[model samples]
Target: MSQAEASQLLGLAGKYRPYPEYKGAGVEWVGDVPEHWRVGRLGSFGYFIAGCGFPHEDQGRQDEIYPFYKVSDTNHVGNEKYLSKADNYVSKDIASKLGARICSAGDYVSQGRGCVAWKQEANSYSGNSDNKCDTHG
Candidate 1:
């Protein structure tokens, strides 16, 4: 989606009225935030993780026993409480080896390459390199 559209969908489009009082946030790019809200770097809240990736053959159409996310999934993420769809799946045995980077519910994922997009997983899931992207809890 275009930046403006994404902003509106993500509720960052200034739909809410401005706070009565405001102070400089110091960063020009981030002029100000709601007066009551404290400002801090995202890192202050959590660490960034580069997810692990499996081989190409390990991903593709399969039984839905375990969901696997990819960059495309971000386009479908909206106001939903959790991400509900994925393009790939794996068997329990494959999942066992891919456990190191299994995305837990509530984790935010962002693509690292082409067609970058982000999504917050609604449930436990997994992904490979294309979607191995960045993640933060």
Candidate 2:
């Protein structure tokens, strides 16, 4: 369809036109969304959790490699670089005290303020550590 035709169908002409038998809260106007679409809060759609911080100096490196991810790692493409080497690992005791949440593949990670972007992918570490998501929860 032509741009003008599409705009007319979408009610972008800037004039208000009422639709048939529509009265709802939180909806300022009709044609803003599809008839079947429903609006809800983010909490209703999914859970929001924050992550925790780990002391940079205390973390150690040893056997058994794992991928460490940070908020900066997520961007337009996703977390392509390893934030930290697996050899530099944290102890289970420290991880537990901090209350870190473990994430698997296909899990979504988002930044709270600075970058304001979300990325989804499988994490390399199956074990737990005090990460960003811990703070949110």
Candidate 3:
């Protein structure tokens, strides 16, 4: 598995079409939001976690029980905005040895490092990311 430099992982969100229906957001910065959508500080919902080091030697076993995603996994053909697959996988044993945790089915995984993760939150965690990732719990 190849690792992308943290610097190379920073990305701007692509443009999305306006929601079909809208309602007042009651917030100045965001004038309106899709109907039925809740607007609140993202922190109120979940925490951003730090990525752990995944040694190259423990990567690439398709027989493993978990998928190990690298920043580049974000760019995989089917993962334009969400990770659908990974080039590498790991067993629970290897993940435990690396002090890594797997984000559950709905959790978010990003390429941002600790210092910039919060700032990238708004752009990083939006859709339902079905794929779990190995991170430091």
| TM-score for candidate 3, residues paired by index | 0.53
Residue 35, candidate 1: Cα error in Å is 1.3
RMSD list, candidates in order: 7.3, 9.5, 11.8
Every model's TM-score: 0.59, 0.45, 0.53
Worst 10 residues of 2 by lDDT: 112-121
Each model's total of backbone clashes? 1, 17, 0
TM-score winner: 1
Which ranges in model 1 have alpha carbons more than 4 Å from their true place? 1-16, 75-81, 91-100, 114-132
lDDT on C-alpha atoms for all candidate structures: 0.56, 0.40, 0.53
What tens-digit string does per-residue lDDT give for candidate 2 at 7-112?
7898875575544443343645432444455666657665655655645664454431233344434332533431222323444554456454544444444444
Candidate 1 backbone collisions, by pair: 83-122
Candidate 1: C-alpha lDDT: 0.56
lDDT of 3: 0.53
Segments of candidate 2 deviating more than 4 angstroms: 1-31, 34-38, 59-66, 75-91, 113-137
